[model samples]
Target chain A: MPYVNVKVAGNLTEDQKRKIVEGITELLQDVAGKPPESTYVVIDEVNRENWGKGGKLLSDKEK
Target chain B: MPYVNVKVAGNLTEDQKRKIVEGITELLQDVAGKPPESTYVVIDEVNRENWGKGGKLLSDKEK
Candidate 1:
């Protein structure tokens, strides 16, 4: 079983989550010959305040 | 920057999550020499219905 975990710096819509799950399953099936039925996709939506990049929290970044 | 994403088949307590984050950070620091400040840990709690193991959905497993 292939378990795919995706982390992002904010919440995502249900549709977005659905697409991600589907896309990852397809990709694994195509590239790694993994079966879609056994592929698991989990999305973790991290708060901006908790996510850091370049030594800075995502929340502190200016838009 | 090292990003860690943990996926589990069910919900976890706040304490458990905290410990996981800390443990992962420490492991990365000790083993990979990654700095704690630049390391990010995200935990994903997946529904049993969505997770499969041994060609069977986790939800379908009998207790």
Candidate 2:
């Protein structure tokens, strides 16, 4: 079983999450010969305050 | 930067999640030479109904 976890920088809509779960499942099945039913995809939405890049929190970065 | 996403079969307590995050951060630093400050650990708690194993959903398995 392949469990794929995706970390996104911000929140996503339900539709977006659904598409991700579906797309990743299909990709794993196509590339790795895994079954869609056995594949698991979880998306973790991270707030900018908790995410850092280049030693700086994303929240503090210039927009 | 190393981003680690942990997928668990069930929910975890905040303390357990914290330990996991800290342990994984240290492991990445030790093995990959990644900085703890740049390491991000996101734990995804999957419901039994969503997690499938052996072609069967965990929720349907016999307890």
Best by TM-score: 1
Candidate 1, residues B1-63: lDDT per residue as tens digits? 798767889887655666677788888889999988888776667899999999999888955
* Per-residue lDDT of A11 in model 1: 94
Residue-level lDDT tens digits of model 2 in A1-63: 998877888899999999999899999889989999999888878765445454444555555
lDDT of 1 at B44: 69
Q: For candidate 2, what's the TM-score of chain A, rounded to 2 decimals?
A: 0.93
Best by DockQ: 1
Looking at model 2, give its docking quality level. Answer: incorrect
lDDT of 2 by residue, B1-63 (tens): 887667889887655665676677777778988988887765567899999999999999956
Report, for all candidates in order, the number of backbone clashes: 0, 0
CAPRI-style docking class of model 1 based on DockQ: incorrect
